[model samples]
Target: MKLNRLELDFFRNYSHVEATFHPRVNLIYGDNAQGKTNLLEAIAYLSSARSHRARYDRELIMLNEPQGYIKGEVDSRERTFILEAKLNRGKTRQLWSNGLRLKTAGELAGILTTVLFCPEDLYLIREGASARRRFLDGAICQLRPRYAQALAEYNRLYEHKTRILRDWQENPSLLDTLDDFNLRMAQFGARIIHYRAHFVRRLGEQAPAIHADFSGGREQLGLRYETVSTVQDPLGSVQDIFESLLKHQESHRRAELDSRQCLSGPHKDDLVVELDGQSAKQFGSQGQTRTAALSLKLAQREIFQQETGEWPVLLLDDVLSELDGKRQSFVLNRIQGGQVFITCCEPEKLDGLERGKSFQIQGGTILSQRSV
Candidate 1:
């Protein structure tokens, strides 16, 4: 899927802006805090109904504005779809596709898939499990709408179960409800885990050569899905893991009550990034960590293309400036002929980037008609 044009109003730094994009390679260059990231965030929000930066609806609105608006035209499945998002004060964000109101985020899924590579993504290996989990969940959700729904259900079940446990002393009856919740929780949680395992397995198959290429063939890389219940028996169905979850709920909750949280299932799962048979988190250098993160994201894009029959729009948010020439060349080689939206402070920092459509961003304004 490729975005043809984008319009935004009252979103972060952009009060009002509209720009058309080339199907392959578009660059937005500006100094810091000049709305480059905000523009990309608006595009991402229009596509996914959420922001990769984790900005809340209220936070996304301009400081003095009561609402935020985003509109985009995308080429998907051989037809153009106009995707729109409206964020009003004290109301849920509203979404529309080609003038039809979308009832759920699932309706908006696959309309425009994007793999964002930002400087912060370099933390995927060294950060806590939440980052890696989000990486896996977000990528898989875009490919499988049902997986997203199942993950949402599992999280809801986890919250409800936690509430009951927190008030257990005063609400003994909630335990029975918790019992019922755990059963469904396990069922949905098992499905999410299964999808993630399958996703990571595919990543393992696709990421090795990518890692080698990105690392100049000096490093061997692998991705492993680390879950308590997902892989105990690969040949078995999620039902088996759910059965195991149901049986262990009592003991797990008894211990977790002391900590006031759900202690088991997909919520606690992690992705183990390995380099040369050692944990990257523990052994990889800063450059290696970033390389691994880049490999994983590129692999995700290719896998997404294979699964969906279309390339995901690529977003590179100031990620290339830090790479050495060799790695930058490798990165450039991979993104040559795709729809890419990039942001950088200095235009000269990007090699062979000025040849593409260029925009100068300053003071929340996009100067789009000029090349320099």
Candidate 2:
């Protein structure tokens, strides 16, 4: 899929702006904090109906603005679609596709798939387990709407269970409902664990070869999905996982009550990365970690393409400058046959790339456009 045009109003720093995009590579160049990342964020928001950088819709609106808007013309599955989103300060965001209102944000999942690579992602290897889990959730949510619904249900159950645990001491009556919440959490958490395990398995199959090639066959990469010990097989059936979660939850009931925390479920799951049989998070050097992260992202893109039969739009937010020439070349060479938007401070960094369109953005406005 590709974005043909984008129109933004009161979104981020862009007050009123519209720009067309090339189906191939499009370079967006600007200095830091000059709206380069903001523009990319808008496009990413269109794909997922949520901002990667902001937790609230109010944060996306311009200063003193009551509301914001983002509209895009997307080409997917041999047809054109008009996707629009309206952001309000104190209300729910509205979303529409092809002039029809969508009931839920998950409805926009498969319409436009995007893979974003930002500077923060370069440190994904050493980041906390939440970040890694987010990586898994974001990618899977876009590809499988069922996973998104299951995740939402699991998180909601987790929150209710935690609140009951936290307040049960004050009101013993709350304990009466804990078992019901625990049962529902197990049902949803089992589905989440199943999906994540399958995704990680596929990622493991695809990422190791890419990492070996990126490292010139000097390094071997591996991925393992870590969940509660009761789960004998992550790839097992839903019933098996549900039983396992129940067993683990029962075992941790006393400890959970003592700590007043929800400590046994998919919420604490992790994706472990190994380089040459050692933990990448604990032992990999800076370069090795970066390469591992890149391989993982590229593998994600490939997995999307394999499942959907088309390449997802690639968004690189000033990530090339963080990589050396060899690694940059490796990434650029691997991203063919798809639409790409790359933001960079130095235009010379793209000098060796093939011809494409280039835009100069300044102060949330498009200054000029030229063929690169």
Candidate 3:
């Protein structure tokens, strides 16, 4: 998958900008807050229909603008297609692919997948379980439509159940339907766990090898999917897992009520990472964590290619600058065979990369486009 062309209007700081892209490597360089990352975000959004930075669609629009637009002419599976997203402040947002309306963001999955490694991702190994879960969700949602649907439904049920748990004392009527919510949530949660288990298994195959090479065989990375204990086998059938989920939910029901929180689902799942048989979250150093995180992302990209038979676009958003010379070289070496966008504060940061187009961005506009 590749984004051949992009156009932005009233999005972020860009009033209007259009540019063609290099399929191999496109470098975006500029000073801070000059929209380099914004351009990458626009391309990434076409696949996931989400901004990695912004929580709300309206925040992606320019100040005082009624709407913002992002359009990409993409090449996927050797065919050309147009993806469009319109963000409105007061009204609903719209997504379209090749002129037909897309009902949900999940519809955009798998068409143009992206493996994004940003500065914040450097802390993945040490961050809490929620961040690792997001790592799984972001990658899986783009690759599996069924997993995406299950996750969305499970999230909705979680929200509903949380409100019920939090307010049942004041409004006892909310308790009337809690059992129904639990059953349905277990159904979806089971599916999500099944998918996550399989995906993390794939990661297990790739990430450790990559990390071993990255660490010069000094560290052996290990991965295991961690979920509620009652669900003994995450890879089991949906019915079996669903029953286990319901059982676990019952076990935690009283604890949840006491704490007034929803804490009894796959929503609390984690990807346990170990380095040399030690918990990476607790023992990994800064450099080790960042390298492990990079390995995980590159492994994710490899998994995407293996599943889809094509390379997903890779976006390295200011992550190269965070790495030391050797680690940066490691990332640059592994990122070939696919379209890549690298953002940095200056063009010199991309000195080792050869043969690509470089865009100088300033004030949300492309100041220049030149071959590097």
Candidate 4:
């Protein structure tokens, strides 16, 4: 899938701007804080209805503006689509698909998916499980609407359970509903684990080979899914996994109450990355970890293509600057046959690239646009 054009108003630093993109490679160049990254953020928001950089939708709006708007024309699944997102302060974000209002962000799945690689992701191997979990959730939510719905409900229930566990001592009545919450959480958690297990399985299959090739046959990469201790088979049917979650919840009920924590569910799931049978986080070198991280993302992109019959858009946000010449060339060489947006401080950095569109950005505006 590819984004054809984008129009923004009061979004981030942009007061108003409209730009058409090249289908192959779109280069956005500007100094730091001049809105190079914001351009990519807007494209991703139009696709997923969520901002990778901002924690709240209101953060996406301009300093004094009460609301922000984003619209993108996309081509995917052999059809064209117009996706829109409205960000209102102190209110829920609204999304639209082809002029029809959408109730959830999941409704925009598979239309304009993107795989973003930023400087922070280079440290994915060394970061905590939450980083890796976010990686998985971000990719899967765009491909599976049901998984997205289940994940949203599971997170909401987890918050309620946390409040109950923390306040049960002062409000004894809250304890009355704790059992009910546990049962419901398990019901949703089952789907979360099932989908995650299958996704990780596919990732395991692809990332390892890619990692090996990236390392030049010198290292082996492995990915394993880890969930609650009581989940024996994460790939089992939803009903069976639900029962397993319930069993684990029962075993942990006393500890959870004692510690005032919500501890039993897929929220704690992790994708274990190993290099040559050792934990990559603890043992791998910087280059090894970086290579492993790149392999994971490239593998994910391949998976998207295999599933959808079209490659997802690849967004590289100042990632080439962070890599060495060898690594930079490796990444650029591999990202073929798909739409790509690369942001950098200098257009000369990618001087030898084939013909594509280039935009010079300044202060949230496109200073100049040209075809190169």
- lDDT of every model, 2 decimals: 0.83, 0.94, 0.91, 0.92
Please provide, for model 2 over 255-275, each residue's C-alpha lDDT reduced to its tens digit, 9 standing for 90 to 100.
999999999999999999999
For model 1, the local distance difference test gives 0.83
Q: Candidate 2: where are CA atoms >4 Å away?
A: none
* Per-model root-mean-square deviation over C-alphas: 1.9, 1.1, 1.0, 0.8
How does candidate 4 fare on TM-score? 0.99
Off by over 4 Å in 3: none
Which run of 10 residues does model 2 get worst, by summed lDDT?
347-356
Tens digits of lDDT, candidate 3, 239-346 = 999999999989988998889998888988999998888998899888888888988999999999998889999999999888889998999889879899999997
TM-score of each: 0.94, 0.98, 0.98, 0.99
Clashing pairs in 4: none
lDDT of 4 by residue, 60-87 (tens): 9999899999999999999999898989
Better of 1 and 4 by TM-score: 4
- Which residue runs of candidate 4 sit more than 4 Å off their true CA positions? none
Which candidate tops TM-score? 4
Q: Any idea what lDDT model 2 has?
A: 0.94
Rank candidates by lDDT, best first: 2, 4, 3, 1
Candidate 3, TM-score vs. the true structure?
0.98
